[model samples]
Target: MAFHYPNGTPYNNHEAPKSKKQVKKQKSIQFGKRGMDFEEEINKSNAYYLSRNTAVIHKKPTPVQIVKVDYPSRSAAVIKEAYFRQASTTDYNGVYNGFYLDFEAKETKNKTSFPFKNFHQHQIDHIRQCLAQKGICFVLLWFSSLNRCFFFSGEALVTYWAEQETTGKKSLPLAIIEKNGIEIQIGIAPRIPYLDAVEQYIQSKKGVAMNDN
Candidate 1:
Protein backbone atom coordinates (compact mmCIF):
# COMPACT_ATOMS: atom_id res chain seq x y z
CA MET A 1 0.00 0.00 0.00
CA ALA A 2 1.20 3.47 -0.84
CA PHE A 3 2.06 5.57 2.18
CA HIS A 4 -0.08 8.60 2.90
CA TYR A 5 0.64 11.76 4.86
CA PRO A 6 -1.55 12.84 7.75
CA ASN A 7 -3.64 14.98 5.40
CA GLY A 8 -4.23 11.98 3.11
CA THR A 9 -1.77 13.36 0.57
CA PRO A 10 0.16 10.55 -1.10
CA TYR A 11 3.73 10.43 0.11
CA ASN A 12 6.24 11.80 -2.39
CA ASN A 13 8.66 8.93 -1.84
CA HIS A 14 10.74 9.85 -4.81
CA GLU A 15 13.48 12.40 -4.30
CA ALA A 16 12.00 15.90 -4.45
CA PRO A 17 11.78 16.90 -8.11
CA LYS A 18 14.53 19.29 -9.09
CA SER A 19 13.42 22.72 -10.29
CA LYS A 20 16.11 24.84 -11.96
CA LYS A 21 14.01 28.02 -11.65
CA GLN A 22 13.35 27.47 -7.95
CA VAL A 23 17.02 26.74 -7.28
CA LYS A 24 18.06 29.97 -8.99
CA LYS A 25 15.52 32.00 -6.98
CA GLN A 26 16.59 30.41 -3.71
CA LYS A 27 20.22 31.23 -4.48
CA SER A 28 19.25 34.88 -4.95
CA ILE A 29 17.51 35.12 -1.55
CA GLN A 30 19.04 37.71 0.79
CA PHE A 31 20.51 37.01 4.21
CA GLY A 32 20.43 39.29 7.25
CA LYS A 33 20.61 39.20 11.04
CA ARG A 34 19.87 35.61 11.96
CA GLY A 35 18.72 33.86 15.14
CA MET A 36 18.36 30.28 16.27
CA ASP A 37 15.47 28.52 14.56
CA PHE A 38 12.34 28.00 16.64
CA GLU A 39 12.74 24.25 17.02
CA GLU A 40 16.39 24.55 17.96
CA GLU A 41 15.55 27.16 20.58
CA ILE A 42 13.00 24.87 22.11
CA ASN A 43 15.51 22.03 22.17
CA LYS A 44 18.02 24.20 23.97
CA SER A 45 15.39 25.24 26.45
CA ASN A 46 14.56 21.61 27.10
CA ALA A 47 18.25 20.98 27.69
CA TYR A 48 18.36 23.82 30.15
CA TYR A 49 15.41 22.43 32.02
CA LEU A 50 17.04 19.00 32.14
CA SER A 51 20.33 20.44 33.37
CA ARG A 52 18.60 22.13 36.27
CA ASN A 53 16.61 19.01 37.07
CA THR A 54 13.49 21.04 36.55
CA ALA A 55 11.96 18.92 33.78
CA VAL A 56 12.75 15.83 31.77
CA ILE A 57 11.10 16.63 28.47
CA HIS A 58 12.51 15.17 25.30
CA LYS A 59 11.54 14.91 21.65
CA LYS A 60 10.31 11.51 20.63
CA PRO A 61 12.45 9.68 18.08
CA THR A 62 10.78 9.00 14.75
CA PRO A 63 9.52 5.45 14.61
CA VAL A 64 10.83 3.70 11.51
CA GLN A 65 10.77 0.18 10.09
CA ILE A 66 14.04 -0.79 8.55
CA VAL A 67 13.76 -2.95 5.49
CA LYS A 68 17.34 -3.34 4.31
CA VAL A 69 20.81 -2.73 5.70
CA ASP A 70 24.32 -3.06 4.32
CA TYR A 71 27.19 -4.23 6.47
CA PRO A 72 29.66 -1.71 5.08
CA SER A 73 32.34 -2.49 7.67
CA ARG A 74 33.04 -4.20 10.99
CA SER A 75 31.52 -1.34 12.97
CA ALA A 76 29.35 0.25 10.34
CA ALA A 77 25.97 -0.60 8.90
CA VAL A 78 24.11 1.52 6.40
CA ILE A 79 20.33 1.64 6.58
CA LYS A 80 19.31 1.45 2.92
CA GLU A 81 15.55 1.21 3.13
CA ALA A 82 13.31 2.46 5.89
CA TYR A 83 9.91 4.04 6.34
CA PHE A 84 8.17 5.81 9.20
CA ARG A 85 5.74 3.49 10.96
CA GLN A 86 2.93 5.97 11.56
CA ALA A 87 1.99 9.39 12.80
CA SER A 88 3.65 10.41 16.06
CA THR A 89 2.22 11.62 19.34
CA THR A 90 3.03 15.12 20.51
CA ASP A 91 6.68 16.14 20.69
CA TYR A 92 8.43 16.83 24.01
CA ASN A 93 6.83 14.80 26.79
CA GLY A 94 8.11 14.43 30.35
CA VAL A 95 7.45 14.81 34.04
CA TYR A 96 7.54 18.36 35.35
CA ASN A 97 6.94 19.23 38.99
CA GLY A 98 5.07 15.96 39.46
CA PHE A 99 2.85 16.65 36.44
CA TYR A 100 2.98 14.82 33.14
CA LEU A 101 3.59 17.42 30.45
CA ASP A 102 2.95 16.68 26.79
CA PHE A 103 2.88 19.17 23.95
CA GLU A 104 3.42 19.79 20.25
CA ALA A 105 5.41 22.77 19.00
CA LYS A 106 4.51 24.46 15.73
CA GLU A 107 5.46 27.66 13.95
CA THR A 108 3.51 29.53 11.29
CA LYS A 109 4.22 32.54 9.12
CA ASN A 110 0.66 33.78 9.08
CA LYS A 111 0.30 36.64 11.56
CA THR A 112 -3.48 36.64 11.80
CA SER A 113 -4.79 33.12 12.39
CA PHE A 114 -3.45 29.69 13.24
CA PRO A 115 -4.48 27.03 10.75
CA PHE A 116 -5.90 23.90 12.34
CA LYS A 117 -4.25 21.75 9.70
CA ASN A 118 -1.01 21.78 11.74
CA PHE A 119 -2.60 19.24 14.09
CA HIS A 120 -3.78 15.73 13.25
CA GLN A 121 -6.67 13.66 14.56
CA HIS A 122 -4.36 11.08 16.09
CA GLN A 123 -2.54 13.79 18.02
CA ILE A 124 -5.83 15.15 19.30
CA ASP A 125 -6.85 11.69 20.45
CA HIS A 126 -3.53 11.25 22.22
CA ILE A 127 -3.99 14.54 24.01
CA ARG A 128 -7.47 13.49 25.10
CA GLN A 129 -6.16 10.25 26.54
CA CYS A 130 -3.36 12.09 28.33
CA LEU A 131 -5.88 14.52 29.81
CA ALA A 132 -8.07 11.65 30.97
CA GLN A 133 -5.03 10.49 32.98
CA LYS A 134 -4.66 13.99 34.45
CA GLY A 135 -1.66 14.96 32.32
CA ILE A 136 -1.03 18.53 31.21
CA CYS A 137 -1.48 18.63 27.44
CA PHE A 138 -1.07 21.65 25.20
CA VAL A 139 0.30 23.01 21.95
CA LEU A 140 3.07 25.59 21.72
CA LEU A 141 2.26 27.82 18.75
CA TRP A 142 4.82 30.28 17.44
CA PHE A 143 3.86 33.12 15.14
CA SER A 144 7.32 33.60 13.68
CA SER A 145 6.46 36.57 11.55
CA LEU A 146 5.19 38.43 14.61
CA ASN A 147 7.63 36.85 17.07
CA ARG A 148 4.77 35.86 19.34
CA CYS A 149 4.16 32.52 20.99
CA PHE A 150 1.14 31.07 22.75
CA PHE A 151 0.52 28.04 24.93
CA PHE A 152 -2.92 26.76 24.02
CA SER A 153 -4.52 24.08 26.17
CA GLY A 154 -5.29 20.77 24.55
CA GLU A 155 -8.83 21.05 25.87
CA ALA A 156 -9.35 24.35 24.04
CA LEU A 157 -7.90 22.98 20.82
CA VAL A 158 -10.11 19.90 21.03
CA THR A 159 -13.20 22.01 21.59
CA TYR A 160 -12.46 24.19 18.56
CA TRP A 161 -11.53 21.24 16.40
CA ALA A 162 -14.80 19.55 17.29
CA GLU A 163 -16.63 22.77 16.50
CA GLN A 164 -15.13 22.65 13.03
CA GLU A 165 -17.05 19.44 12.53
CA THR A 166 -20.26 21.52 12.70
CA THR A 167 -19.39 25.24 12.54
CA GLY A 168 -17.10 24.90 9.52
CA LYS A 169 -14.41 27.14 11.02
CA LYS A 170 -11.15 25.89 9.57
CA SER A 171 -8.80 28.18 11.47
CA LEU A 172 -8.70 29.53 15.00
CA PRO A 173 -9.06 33.29 14.94
CA LEU A 174 -6.15 35.28 16.44
CA ALA A 175 -8.42 37.24 18.73
CA ILE A 176 -9.81 34.15 20.40
CA ILE A 177 -6.33 32.73 20.94
CA GLU A 178 -5.12 36.03 22.34
CA LYS A 179 -7.87 35.90 24.91
CA ASN A 180 -7.74 32.24 25.83
CA GLY A 181 -4.10 31.36 25.28
CA ILE A 182 -1.10 32.27 27.39
CA GLU A 183 1.41 34.43 25.51
CA ILE A 184 5.07 33.45 25.84
CA GLN A 185 7.92 35.83 25.40
CA ILE A 186 10.84 34.81 23.27
CA GLY A 187 14.24 35.00 24.99
CA ILE A 188 17.85 34.59 24.09
CA ALA A 189 20.17 31.73 25.22
CA PRO A 190 17.37 29.20 25.73
CA ARG A 191 14.83 30.87 23.39
CA ILE A 192 11.15 29.85 23.84
CA PRO A 193 10.44 29.64 27.58
CA TYR A 194 7.22 27.68 27.14
CA LEU A 195 7.12 26.35 30.69
CA ASP A 196 6.55 29.88 31.84
CA ALA A 197 3.48 29.92 29.68
CA VAL A 198 2.50 26.59 31.16
CA GLU A 199 2.81 28.04 34.64
CA GLN A 200 0.56 30.93 33.67
CA TYR A 201 -1.97 28.54 32.17
CA ILE A 202 -1.99 26.52 35.38
CA GLN A 203 -2.51 29.64 37.43
CA SER A 204 -5.36 30.76 35.23
CA LYS A 205 -7.04 27.39 35.49
CA LYS A 206 -6.68 27.43 39.26
CA GLY A 207 -8.07 30.94 39.35
CA VAL A 208 -11.10 29.83 37.38
CA ALA A 209 -11.62 26.86 39.70
CA MET A 210 -11.42 29.10 42.72
CA ASN A 211 -13.91 31.53 41.22
CA ASP A 212 -16.30 28.66 40.45
CA ASN A 213 -16.19 27.58 44.07
Candidate 2:
Protein backbone atom coordinates (compact mmCIF):
# COMPACT_ATOMS: atom_id res chain seq x y z
CA MET A 1 0.00 0.00 0.00
CA ALA A 2 1.20 3.48 -0.83
CA PHE A 3 1.71 5.86 2.07
CA HIS A 4 0.00 9.19 1.81
CA TYR A 5 0.54 12.45 3.60
CA PRO A 6 -2.17 14.23 5.59
CA ASN A 7 -3.20 16.14 2.48
CA GLY A 8 -3.44 12.96 0.39
CA THR A 9 -0.05 13.20 -1.31
CA PRO A 10 1.58 9.81 -1.30
CA TYR A 11 4.92 9.83 0.44
CA ASN A 12 6.93 7.13 2.06
CA ASN A 13 9.79 7.86 4.42
CA HIS A 14 11.98 5.45 2.48
CA GLU A 15 11.82 6.74 -1.09
CA ALA A 16 10.07 10.05 -0.78
CA PRO A 17 12.16 13.18 -1.36
CA LYS A 18 12.55 15.58 1.51
CA SER A 19 10.19 18.36 0.52
CA LYS A 20 8.00 20.59 2.58
CA LYS A 21 4.99 20.38 0.31
CA GLN A 22 4.55 17.41 -1.95
CA VAL A 23 2.65 17.56 -5.20
CA LYS A 24 -0.91 16.48 -4.40
CA LYS A 25 -1.27 13.75 -6.97
CA GLN A 26 -0.98 10.04 -7.57
CA LYS A 27 0.28 7.91 -10.44
CA SER A 28 -0.92 4.42 -11.21
CA ILE A 29 1.33 1.38 -11.57
CA GLN A 30 0.67 -2.12 -12.82
CA PHE A 31 0.90 -5.29 -10.79
CA GLY A 32 3.91 -7.56 -9.95
CA LYS A 33 6.46 -4.69 -9.77
CA ARG A 34 4.75 -2.70 -7.07
CA GLY A 35 6.66 -2.12 -3.85
CA MET A 36 7.45 0.25 -0.98
CA ASP A 37 8.64 3.87 -1.17
CA PHE A 38 11.96 4.71 -2.86
CA GLU A 39 13.95 5.86 0.15
CA GLU A 40 13.01 2.75 2.11
CA GLU A 41 14.25 0.59 -0.71
CA ILE A 42 17.56 2.42 -0.92
CA ASN A 43 18.08 2.09 2.83
CA LYS A 44 17.35 -1.62 2.65
CA SER A 45 19.67 -1.99 -0.31
CA ASN A 46 22.42 -0.22 1.58
CA ALA A 47 21.89 -2.58 4.46
CA TYR A 48 22.17 -5.56 2.13
CA TYR A 49 25.38 -4.23 0.72
CA LEU A 50 26.77 -3.57 4.17
CA SER A 51 25.89 -7.06 5.42
CA ARG A 52 27.68 -8.66 2.50
CA ASN A 53 30.70 -6.36 2.84
CA THR A 54 30.08 -5.33 -0.75
CA ALA A 55 30.41 -1.66 0.19
CA VAL A 56 30.62 0.70 3.12
CA ILE A 57 28.30 3.46 1.95
CA HIS A 58 26.47 5.34 4.69
CA LYS A 59 24.12 8.26 4.90
CA LYS A 60 25.84 11.32 6.27
CA PRO A 61 24.67 12.50 9.64
CA THR A 62 22.73 15.73 9.70
CA PRO A 63 25.02 18.63 10.54
CA VAL A 64 23.83 19.99 13.84
CA GLN A 65 25.54 22.28 16.35
CA ILE A 66 24.43 21.67 19.89
CA VAL A 67 24.23 24.96 21.73
CA LYS A 68 22.63 23.97 25.05
CA VAL A 69 22.02 20.66 26.74
CA ASP A 70 20.11 19.91 29.92
CA TYR A 71 20.88 16.88 32.01
CA PRO A 72 17.69 15.72 33.68
CA SER A 73 18.04 13.34 36.64
CA ARG A 74 21.45 12.22 35.44
CA SER A 75 19.77 9.83 33.07
CA ALA A 76 18.62 11.94 30.15
CA ALA A 77 20.26 14.90 28.48
CA VAL A 78 17.82 17.14 26.63
CA ILE A 79 18.93 19.29 23.76
CA LYS A 80 17.65 22.74 24.69
CA GLU A 81 19.22 24.64 21.84
CA ALA A 82 20.64 23.49 18.54
CA TYR A 83 21.17 24.68 15.02
CA PHE A 84 22.26 23.26 11.73
CA ARG A 85 26.01 23.69 11.41
CA GLN A 86 26.10 23.90 7.63
CA ALA A 87 24.97 22.21 4.48
CA SER A 88 26.34 18.71 4.04
CA THR A 89 28.42 17.54 1.08
CA THR A 90 26.04 14.85 -0.13
CA ASP A 91 23.65 12.24 1.15
CA TYR A 92 25.79 9.14 0.93
CA ASN A 93 29.53 8.40 0.58
CA GLY A 94 31.83 5.45 1.03
CA VAL A 95 34.56 3.23 -0.43
CA TYR A 96 33.61 0.64 -2.99
CA ASN A 97 36.05 -1.59 -4.87
CA GLY A 98 38.94 0.73 -3.90
CA PHE A 99 37.16 3.73 -5.39
CA TYR A 100 35.58 6.51 -3.41
CA LEU A 101 31.86 6.75 -4.09
CA ASP A 102 29.77 9.78 -3.23
CA PHE A 103 26.22 10.58 -4.16
CA GLU A 104 22.90 12.15 -3.26
CA ALA A 105 19.51 10.51 -3.45
CA LYS A 106 16.45 12.45 -4.52
CA GLU A 107 12.90 11.88 -5.68
CA THR A 108 10.53 13.79 -7.92
CA LYS A 109 6.96 13.39 -8.99
CA ASN A 110 7.22 15.81 -11.89
CA LYS A 111 6.42 14.02 -15.12
CA THR A 112 8.12 16.54 -17.35
CA SER A 113 11.48 17.48 -15.88
CA PHE A 114 13.68 16.92 -12.85
CA PRO A 115 13.82 20.31 -11.16
CA PHE A 116 17.16 21.92 -10.28
CA LYS A 117 15.58 23.15 -7.07
CA ASN A 118 15.93 19.63 -5.70
CA PHE A 119 19.69 20.14 -5.55
CA HIS A 120 21.59 22.77 -3.61
CA GLN A 121 24.43 24.86 -5.04
CA HIS A 122 26.71 23.54 -2.33
CA GLN A 123 26.03 19.99 -3.50
CA ILE A 124 26.94 20.87 -7.07
CA ASP A 125 30.21 22.38 -5.98
CA HIS A 126 30.92 19.38 -3.76
CA ILE A 127 30.37 17.00 -6.66
CA ARG A 128 32.74 19.02 -8.76
CA GLN A 129 35.37 18.92 -6.02
CA CYS A 130 34.89 15.16 -5.61
CA LEU A 131 35.28 14.67 -9.36
CA ALA A 132 38.58 16.54 -9.18
CA GLN A 133 39.74 13.97 -6.62
CA LYS A 134 38.68 11.07 -8.92
CA GLY A 135 35.72 10.01 -6.81
CA ILE A 136 32.85 8.12 -8.42
CA CYS A 137 30.12 10.67 -7.97
CA PHE A 138 26.49 10.38 -8.99
CA VAL A 139 22.87 10.97 -8.01
CA LEU A 140 20.06 8.50 -7.49
CA LEU A 141 17.04 10.09 -9.10
CA TRP A 142 13.71 8.52 -8.26
CA PHE A 143 10.82 9.36 -10.55
CA SER A 144 7.95 8.48 -8.26
CA SER A 145 5.20 9.03 -10.76
CA LEU A 146 6.82 6.89 -13.41
CA ASN A 147 8.14 4.28 -10.99
CA ARG A 148 11.59 4.66 -12.52
CA CYS A 149 15.03 5.19 -11.03
CA PHE A 150 18.16 6.50 -12.72
CA PHE A 151 21.77 6.67 -11.65
CA PHE A 152 23.04 9.83 -13.30
CA SER A 153 26.65 10.87 -13.15
CA GLY A 154 27.68 14.00 -11.29
CA GLU A 155 29.43 15.28 -14.42
CA ALA A 156 26.16 15.37 -16.35
CA LEU A 157 24.26 16.96 -13.48
CA VAL A 158 27.01 19.54 -12.95
CA THR A 159 27.28 20.38 -16.66
CA TYR A 160 23.56 20.83 -17.04
CA TRP A 161 23.25 22.78 -13.79
CA ALA A 162 25.93 25.18 -15.01
CA GLU A 163 24.19 25.71 -18.36
CA GLN A 164 20.76 26.44 -16.88
CA GLU A 165 21.10 30.16 -17.61
CA THR A 166 22.42 29.74 -21.14
CA THR A 167 20.06 26.96 -22.13
CA GLY A 168 17.11 28.18 -20.09
CA LYS A 169 16.41 24.57 -19.15
CA LYS A 170 15.04 24.69 -15.65
CA SER A 171 14.95 20.93 -15.43
CA LEU A 172 16.41 17.79 -16.98
CA PRO A 173 14.11 16.06 -19.41
CA LEU A 174 13.52 12.32 -19.31
CA ALA A 175 15.01 11.94 -22.76
CA ILE A 176 18.36 13.41 -21.76
CA ILE A 177 18.44 11.19 -18.69
CA GLU A 178 17.53 8.12 -20.73
CA LYS A 179 20.52 8.72 -22.97
CA ASN A 180 23.06 9.44 -20.27
CA GLY A 181 21.85 7.68 -17.11
CA ILE A 182 21.48 4.07 -16.11
CA GLU A 183 17.99 2.92 -15.17
CA ILE A 184 17.73 0.71 -12.09
CA GLN A 185 15.25 -2.00 -11.24
CA ILE A 186 13.48 -1.92 -7.89
CA GLY A 187 13.48 -5.19 -5.99
CA ILE A 188 12.22 -6.58 -2.70
CA ALA A 189 15.36 -7.75 -0.86
CA PRO A 190 17.44 -4.60 -1.48
CA ARG A 191 14.83 -2.16 -2.85
CA ILE A 192 16.61 0.49 -5.00
CA PRO A 193 19.52 -1.73 -6.11
CA TYR A 194 21.38 1.39 -7.18
CA LEU A 195 24.80 -0.11 -6.57
CA ASP A 196 24.06 -2.71 -9.22
CA ALA A 197 23.31 0.15 -11.54
CA VAL A 198 26.56 1.80 -10.48
CA GLU A 199 28.54 -1.32 -11.32
CA GLN A 200 26.95 -1.36 -14.74
CA TYR A 201 27.77 2.31 -15.23
CA ILE A 202 31.40 1.76 -14.21
CA GLN A 203 31.72 -1.16 -16.57
CA SER A 204 30.20 0.80 -19.41
CA LYS A 205 32.73 3.56 -18.88
CA LYS A 206 35.51 0.97 -18.83
CA GLY A 207 34.43 -0.30 -22.26
CA VAL A 208 35.43 -3.84 -23.29
CA ALA A 209 38.92 -3.76 -21.76
CA MET A 210 37.81 -5.46 -18.53
CA ASN A 211 36.13 -8.20 -20.53
CA ASP A 212 38.85 -8.69 -23.16
CA ASN A 213 41.85 -11.03 -22.91
Candidate 3:
Protein backbone atom coordinates (compact mmCIF):
# COMPACT_ATOMS: atom_id res chain seq x y z
CA MET A 1 0.00 0.00 0.00
CA ALA A 2 1.17 3.50 -0.86
CA PHE A 3 0.41 6.38 1.47
CA HIS A 4 0.14 9.97 0.31
CA TYR A 5 0.10 13.36 1.93
CA PRO A 6 -3.02 15.50 1.87
CA ASN A 7 -1.35 17.49 -0.90
CA GLY A 8 -1.62 14.47 -3.21
CA THR A 9 2.10 13.79 -3.04
CA PRO A 10 3.57 10.44 -2.01
CA TYR A 11 4.26 10.13 1.69
CA ASN A 12 7.84 9.17 2.42
CA ASN A 13 9.36 8.62 5.80
CA HIS A 14 12.87 9.43 4.57
CA GLU A 15 14.09 12.52 2.77
CA ALA A 16 15.08 12.40 -0.90
CA PRO A 17 18.07 10.27 -1.78
CA LYS A 18 21.34 11.69 -0.49
CA SER A 19 24.03 13.03 -2.83
CA LYS A 20 27.50 11.47 -2.94
CA LYS A 21 28.84 14.09 -0.57
CA GLN A 22 25.96 13.54 1.85
CA VAL A 23 26.53 9.78 1.75
CA LYS A 24 30.23 10.29 2.46
CA LYS A 25 29.40 12.54 5.42
CA GLN A 26 26.94 9.97 6.77
CA LYS A 27 29.44 7.15 6.38
CA SER A 28 31.99 9.06 8.42
CA ILE A 29 29.64 9.55 11.38
CA GLN A 30 30.00 6.80 14.00
CA PHE A 31 26.49 6.14 15.22
CA GLY A 32 25.88 4.52 18.56
CA LYS A 33 25.94 0.72 18.69
CA ARG A 34 22.65 0.81 20.59
CA GLY A 35 20.42 -1.73 18.83
CA MET A 36 17.38 0.46 18.17
CA ASP A 37 16.67 3.80 16.50
CA PHE A 38 15.95 6.82 18.68
CA GLU A 39 12.18 6.68 18.31
CA GLU A 40 12.07 2.93 18.90
CA GLU A 41 14.17 3.30 22.02
CA ILE A 42 11.75 5.90 23.31
CA ASN A 43 8.82 3.62 22.56
CA LYS A 44 10.36 0.76 24.50
CA SER A 45 11.07 3.13 27.38
CA ASN A 46 7.45 4.21 27.37
CA ALA A 47 6.35 0.60 27.53
CA TYR A 48 8.68 -0.03 30.42
CA TYR A 49 7.31 2.97 32.27
CA LEU A 50 3.76 1.88 31.61
CA SER A 51 4.41 -1.65 32.87
CA ARG A 52 5.96 -0.35 36.07
CA ASN A 53 3.22 2.27 36.56
CA THR A 54 5.87 4.96 36.41
CA ALA A 55 4.16 7.15 33.76
CA VAL A 56 1.62 6.96 30.99
CA ILE A 57 3.08 7.89 27.62
CA HIS A 58 2.44 6.83 24.07
CA LYS A 59 3.22 7.97 20.54
CA LYS A 60 0.33 9.74 18.88
CA PRO A 61 -0.90 7.72 15.92
CA THR A 62 -1.07 9.39 12.55
CA PRO A 63 -4.60 9.58 11.22
CA VAL A 64 -4.88 8.08 7.75
CA GLN A 65 -7.84 8.00 5.38
CA ILE A 66 -7.91 4.77 3.46
CA VAL A 67 -8.66 5.46 -0.16
CA LYS A 68 -8.74 2.06 -1.86
CA VAL A 69 -8.88 -1.50 -0.56
CA ASP A 70 -8.61 -4.78 -2.38
CA TYR A 71 -9.52 -8.21 -1.06
CA PRO A 72 -6.54 -10.23 -2.16
CA SER A 73 -8.15 -13.21 -0.40
CA ARG A 74 -11.43 -13.84 1.30
CA SER A 75 -9.87 -13.10 4.68
CA ALA A 76 -7.25 -10.55 3.70
CA ALA A 77 -7.95 -6.98 2.66
CA VAL A 78 -5.01 -4.93 1.40
CA ILE A 79 -5.13 -1.20 1.30
CA LYS A 80 -3.98 0.09 -2.04
CA GLU A 81 -3.68 3.80 -1.21
CA ALA A 82 -4.29 6.15 1.66
CA TYR A 83 -3.85 9.80 2.59
CA PHE A 84 -3.03 11.51 5.83
CA ARG A 85 -6.09 13.23 7.28
CA GLN A 86 -3.93 16.02 8.64
CA ALA A 87 -0.36 16.80 9.41
CA SER A 88 0.94 15.58 12.76
CA THR A 89 1.25 18.11 15.56
CA THR A 90 4.17 16.56 17.37
CA ASP A 91 5.65 13.14 17.96
CA TYR A 92 4.55 12.14 21.46
CA ASN A 93 2.43 13.39 24.38
CA GLY A 94 1.09 11.94 27.64
CA VAL A 95 0.67 12.38 31.37
CA TYR A 96 3.58 11.88 33.72
CA ASN A 97 3.57 12.45 37.51
CA GLY A 98 0.25 14.30 37.31
CA PHE A 99 1.58 16.78 34.75
CA TYR A 100 0.89 16.79 31.01
CA LEU A 101 3.91 15.82 28.98
CA ASP A 102 4.37 16.59 25.30
CA PHE A 103 7.48 16.32 23.18
CA GLU A 104 9.10 15.66 19.84
CA ALA A 105 11.95 13.17 19.31
CA LYS A 106 14.72 14.12 16.91
CA GLU A 107 18.08 12.59 16.05
CA THR A 108 21.03 13.89 14.11
CA LYS A 109 24.23 12.40 12.77
CA ASN A 110 25.93 15.79 12.83
CA LYS A 111 28.45 15.95 15.62
CA THR A 112 28.38 19.67 16.31
CA SER A 113 24.87 21.00 15.63
CA PHE A 114 21.20 20.19 15.21
CA PRO A 115 19.58 21.78 12.20
CA PHE A 116 16.37 23.79 12.65
CA LYS A 117 14.98 22.03 9.61
CA ASN A 118 14.04 19.06 11.84
CA PHE A 119 11.12 21.13 13.12
CA HIS A 120 8.14 22.45 11.24
CA GLN A 121 6.22 25.65 11.95
CA HIS A 122 3.10 23.70 12.90
CA GLN A 123 5.00 21.79 15.55
CA ILE A 124 6.34 25.04 16.98
CA ASP A 125 2.84 26.46 17.10
CA HIS A 126 1.56 23.34 18.82
CA ILE A 127 4.30 23.56 21.41
CA ARG A 128 3.49 27.22 21.99
CA GLN A 129 -0.11 26.28 22.71
CA CYS A 130 1.02 23.61 25.16
CA LEU A 131 3.24 26.17 26.86
CA ALA A 132 0.29 28.55 27.14
CA GLN A 133 -1.53 25.89 29.13
CA LYS A 134 1.49 25.38 31.39
CA GLY A 135 1.84 21.80 30.16
CA ILE A 136 5.23 20.13 30.37
CA CYS A 137 6.84 20.38 26.93
CA PHE A 138 10.29 19.33 25.76
CA VAL A 139 12.15 17.56 22.99
CA LEU A 140 14.40 14.49 23.06
CA LEU A 141 17.43 15.23 20.88
CA TRP A 142 19.68 12.28 20.12
CA PHE A 143 23.22 12.90 18.91
CA SER A 144 23.88 9.58 17.19
CA SER A 145 27.56 10.22 16.52
CA LEU A 146 28.32 10.95 20.18
CA ASN A 147 25.74 8.52 21.56
CA ARG A 148 24.33 11.38 23.61
CA CYS A 149 20.79 12.61 24.18
CA PHE A 150 19.29 15.64 25.92
CA PHE A 151 15.92 16.83 27.05
CA PHE A 152 15.53 20.29 25.54
CA SER A 153 12.60 22.24 26.94
CA GLY A 154 9.99 23.78 24.68
CA GLU A 155 10.55 27.29 26.05
CA ALA A 156 14.23 27.10 25.19
CA LEU A 157 13.46 25.76 21.75
CA VAL A 158 11.10 28.66 21.03
CA THR A 159 13.75 31.12 22.18
CA TYR A 160 16.36 29.74 19.78
CA TRP A 161 13.88 29.16 17.00
CA ALA A 162 12.95 32.85 16.99
CA GLU A 163 16.58 33.92 16.98
CA GLN A 164 17.00 32.51 13.49
CA GLU A 165 15.98 35.75 11.81
CA THR A 166 17.52 38.11 14.35
CA THR A 167 20.79 36.32 14.97
CA GLY A 168 21.20 34.63 11.57
CA LYS A 169 21.87 31.29 13.26
CA LYS A 170 20.15 28.38 11.55
CA SER A 171 21.02 25.53 13.92
CA LEU A 172 21.20 24.98 17.66
CA PRO A 173 24.81 24.42 18.61
CA LEU A 174 25.64 21.40 20.80
CA ALA A 175 27.20 23.67 23.43
CA ILE A 176 23.94 25.56 23.92
CA ILE A 177 21.95 22.33 24.28
CA GLU A 178 24.49 20.90 26.72
CA LYS A 179 24.23 23.97 28.89
CA ASN A 180 20.43 24.19 29.00
CA GLY A 181 19.15 20.68 28.44
CA ILE A 182 19.13 17.75 30.85
CA GLU A 183 21.36 14.86 29.82
CA ILE A 184 19.83 11.38 29.93
CA GLN A 185 21.99 8.32 30.34
CA ILE A 186 21.31 5.37 28.10
CA GLY A 187 20.08 2.24 29.87
CA ILE A 188 19.19 -1.39 29.13
CA ALA A 189 15.49 -2.06 29.99
CA PRO A 190 14.42 1.50 29.37
CA ARG A 191 16.88 2.27 26.59
CA ILE A 192 16.18 6.00 26.82
CA PRO A 193 15.91 6.87 30.50
CA TYR A 194 14.26 10.26 30.03
CA LEU A 195 11.93 10.39 33.03
CA ASP A 196 14.92 11.30 35.16
CA ALA A 197 15.26 14.41 33.08
CA VAL A 198 11.53 15.00 33.39
CA GLU A 199 11.75 14.79 37.16
CA GLN A 200 14.62 17.23 37.18
CA TYR A 201 12.63 19.55 34.95
CA ILE A 202 9.68 19.41 37.34
CA GLN A 203 11.96 20.27 40.21
CA SER A 204 13.44 23.26 38.37
CA LYS A 205 9.96 24.59 37.71
CA LYS A 206 9.21 24.58 41.45
CA GLY A 207 12.46 26.39 42.19
CA VAL A 208 13.59 23.39 44.15
CA ALA A 209 17.06 22.20 43.19
CA MET A 210 17.40 18.44 43.44
CA ASN A 211 19.22 15.71 41.54
CA ASP A 212 18.02 12.14 41.93
CA ASN A 213 20.97 10.71 40.12
Which candidate number maximizes TM-score? 1
Give RMSD to native, each candidate.
9.1, 6.8, 8.3
Question: Per-prediction count of colliding residue pairs?
Answer: 0, 5, 0
TM-score of candidate 3 to 2 decimals:
0.78
**Residue pairs whose backbone atoms clash in candidate 3:** none
The CA-based lDDT of model 3 is what? 0.79
Worst 10 residues of 3 by lDDT: 11-20
Write down the worst ten-residue block by lDDT for model 1.
24-33
The superposed Cα distance between candidate 2 and the true structure at residue 184, in angstroms, equals 0.3
lDDT of each candidate versus the true structure: 0.75, 0.76, 0.79
Q: Write the per-residue lDDT of candidate 3 for residues 1-213, one digit (tens) a residue.
A: 222225554522223333335333432222245534576578878988988999988876655699999998999998899865545578688898799999998877778998887778888899999999999999999988788999999999998998985987879999999999999999897889999999999889877433433
